[model samples]
Target: MAKAFASQGDLEEKKTSFTEIGRGLWAFTAEGDPNSGVIIGDDSVMVIEAQATPRLARKVIDEIRKVTDKPITHLVLTHYHAVRVLGASAYGAGQVIMSDKARAMVAERGKEDWESEFARFPRLFQGHESIPGLTWPTTTFSDRMTVYLGKRKVELMHLGRAHTAGDIVAWVPDEGVMFTGDIVEYRSACYCGDGHFADWGRTLDRIAAFAPQSIAPGRGDALVGPDMVAAAIESTRDFVDSTYRPVERVVARGGSLREAWEAVRAACDPKFADYAIYEHCLPFNVARAYDEAQGIDTPRIWTAQRDREMWDALQG
Candidate 1:
């Protein structure tokens, strides 16, 4: 039987959980669904990665109210994927922050991505009508930006291009906890449709330098403690390198796209088969890796039609 395309078959909703990784810091994860984070400081709260809609984001807000009543004053878009950014208005945050490159991506492809992702994952788009429109960051920084929630400080930095061209991670210096958007996925398939394979591995090296005590990845459970943090980073590094390296080798041998895709699926599926979004992401992942292996640097924007065309090209 042919597998369902992207998330079309993902009808079952996941149960969400809030794991407190540090004092006043929490990771909200929903079983491979897009995850979010909350950081409470002395004066206010900062949310990392908004859910897909106001209704979904309210659930995170509800979780926030349980621990701290601090107003959600800051919202950080780790990158401009619609699942991460469209829910911005729900928080009524004073400042919506993103990397300058990310802001440009949003401006350039936000509508297409919004349409593209919505079609891919319908389950994540509950209450989609409530979303006002494309999420625009009120503030954008080139390299790094710091926000002080009283004495606590949260720093946003674009380590390098990995998951997306504009990918960024949130680092809490005092807490020693990092919120890596999609740059790292723990035990979950790395969605490299918009990723830079070589740069991603180099970027992961930069993340390792911080030696975060705990790390919240784009998907999967939070990595608590230094040992777990290191393991997850290495695992993500390995996952990216493993999946793409094999495909790269095949492409260098003048293999067809199908051959490259088969090489990656054969290598990755044995281990990552049960990982979140593995089936949904594999084709796109292979397509991008194939292009990158052939020396494409910037990832092409994905439209709903582009997604289907690639899916059919590989799976038909």
Candidate 2:
């Protein structure tokens, strides 16, 4: 392949910012890179997504230190993806929480995913060696779990499947503030390499039902007002639709993978060419869409070797 994995050329560091979307809810966004959120309550704090490495995670800690002295009592993983969950050891929180399905994913594919992702996006995992190992949750719940940072009520729920089978969204009901992991990226390309297309659209509906006032998506700037929130969700839906529909149409006509890939570029590039990671996500996204549209229910595991093989076949 001419280009590096996904983001190899994306070497310039983004300027990270900590913005307060609600009274005590914060979003740590870095241009269109992966984001992390913070929820502060009367006595303690909860971090929504851990960075790719402990060293990268500490930057979030530094920002946390600037605003509150409260100990980070809880760590939450929105999914089992390495970039989102591998830095759990950095917080030293009392407990780490995730959906039970996410825990199972870790048990089954954690090592492979770790290797696959590290090679795909080297920029995100700057402090690669600082990672202790695959992040293991100290606590796991099924559908919903309600925890309080003193009086503040934060609800964690698995709202169906979008980004991954085990994706979860953190909701602060009191403020209508939401932390949607990779499920609702704004402007940035959604990495649907392991996603459920139709089910993902349904899951987004579940989020829209909440009518959140402010949202901190997995990437891009945090959406603040209700109007902004609505637009973000719509755009996400559009991205999903545009990518899948073309590929599905090609599949329906019994087209080849390369044919579907060409149709995808003609359809998506016009709309998403400027989106972050567009080049990197295109091959994987097309492959998965082709499979799902052809009746493959589960996304195939992406091992490091498989990554190279697929990239070579498509981009070579």
Q: Give Cα-based local distance difference scores for all models.
A: 0.91, 0.92
Q: Which stretches of candidate 1 lie over 4 Å from their true place?
A: none
**In order, what is each prediction's RMSD in angstroms?**
0.9, 1.0
lDDT of 1: 0.91
TM-score of each: 0.98, 0.98
Query: What TM-score would you give candidate 2 relative to the actual structure?
Result: 0.98
Question: Model 2, range 24-63, lDDT digits (tens) per residue?
Answer: 8999999988899999999999999998899889989999
- Residue 235, model 1: lDDT of 84
After aligning candidate 1 to the native by TM-score, how far in Å is the CA of 29 from where it should be? 0.3
How far in Å is the alpha carbon of 199 misplaced in model 1? 0.6
Report the C-alpha displacement of residue 150, candidate 1, in angstroms: 1.1
